[model samples]
Target: MASAQDAGRGWSMAGRCLTALVGGYAAAAGLATLLARLLPVARVEATAWGMILSFLFYAAFGLWAFHEPRLARVAGVIWGIAIVTGGAALLLGVRP
Candidate 1:
């Protein structure tokens, strides 16, 4: 039988994985949209760069989620960033 500590660790790992997958993607998408909208470069170039940079953003955020000691704090910060950036993109009329 699995010990209580092992089960708790498993649950924590699952939560971190979920946060990295979902929150990372959300944050990356929001950042890309914001960058594409705010960049001073040409629209095509801006969009291209934004899309390219999104992969890096996702990876970085995923790593951060895994490294964080507190799952709740990680989730809160990641989701907060995603929500704020998404709202900013919408308010700025980013269409992509």
Candidate 2:
């Protein structure tokens, strides 16, 4: 029922939206972790979660771009989970 253009458009929108959210978080986290030493009071690195959040964010975008609602939903859930506990894991060095 869907045309190729429609599919492509859908995917593009998904990718754009997902990237905006996830990419923003990843950038901020990276800056915080890497720049922590800028101040004498350095904060703990949230580097552990860096990989998962970055991965899931792009994965969700890619999945949604393909119009795979099921997979996109799964990825969205994972993204949510990652955001919720990602910082904790990074702080504690516990892999999620």
Candidate 3:
């Protein structure tokens, strides 16, 4: 019973959900790795701090994914952060 427009909208919503989950998690992980490396603390403390902050990053990314009006923009920002942070983490010698 759905019209074409409805189907398209459904797909768009689905894309947003996918981005929020996967992209958000990726961004969070990258940020955590980078922070773990950068924090001026003992290794154990820095890693613990990174793990705590990663949850915030993920939640913030998820909220932003929903708040942005354009789907492409949402994907770009989320994925862009993921790539940049991940790349930086790798460059800093953070092990996978």
Candidate 4:
């Protein structure tokens, strides 16, 4: 049987992994925005919702693939939040 202490430690590590994924995604998105400002991006005919969905979906999937259960769930939540934020930003027409 697994020890309680082991379980606790596992949970903590998983939490850290999830945190890292979400944090990494946010950092990446910010960097992308910066790059977009500094350099011209190829013009695309994509809608705001489409961009948001792709960004968040891939971010969450990336996180899940990189780690175990608890971490995956956390990353998933973070991606979800980002998606919602993206929607809000879209409605407000807030660029970056």
Alpha-carbon lDDT, every model:
0.89, 0.48, 0.91, 0.52
- Which one is best on lDDT? 3
On TM-score, the leading prediction is 3
| lDDT assessment of candidate 4 | 0.52
> In model 1, what lDDT does residue 5 have?
62
Global local distance difference test of model 2: 0.48
Mind giving the per-residue lDDT tens digits that candidate 2 earns over 1-96? 335758976765565456446643544454334333232441444444443355554555445534554645545654555454445446645222
TM-scores for candidates 1 onward, in order: 0.85, 0.35, 0.87, 0.34
Top-down lDDT ranking? 3, 1, 4, 2
lDDT comparison, 3 vs 4, better candidate: 3
Clashing pairs in 3: none
Residue 46, candidate 4: how far off, in angstroms? 14
State the weakest 10-residue window (summed lDDT) of model 3.
1-10
Residue 43 shift from truth in candidate 3, angstroms: 1.1
TM-score of predicted model 3?
Answer: 0.87
Q: C-alpha displacement of 85 in model 3, angstroms?
A: 0.5
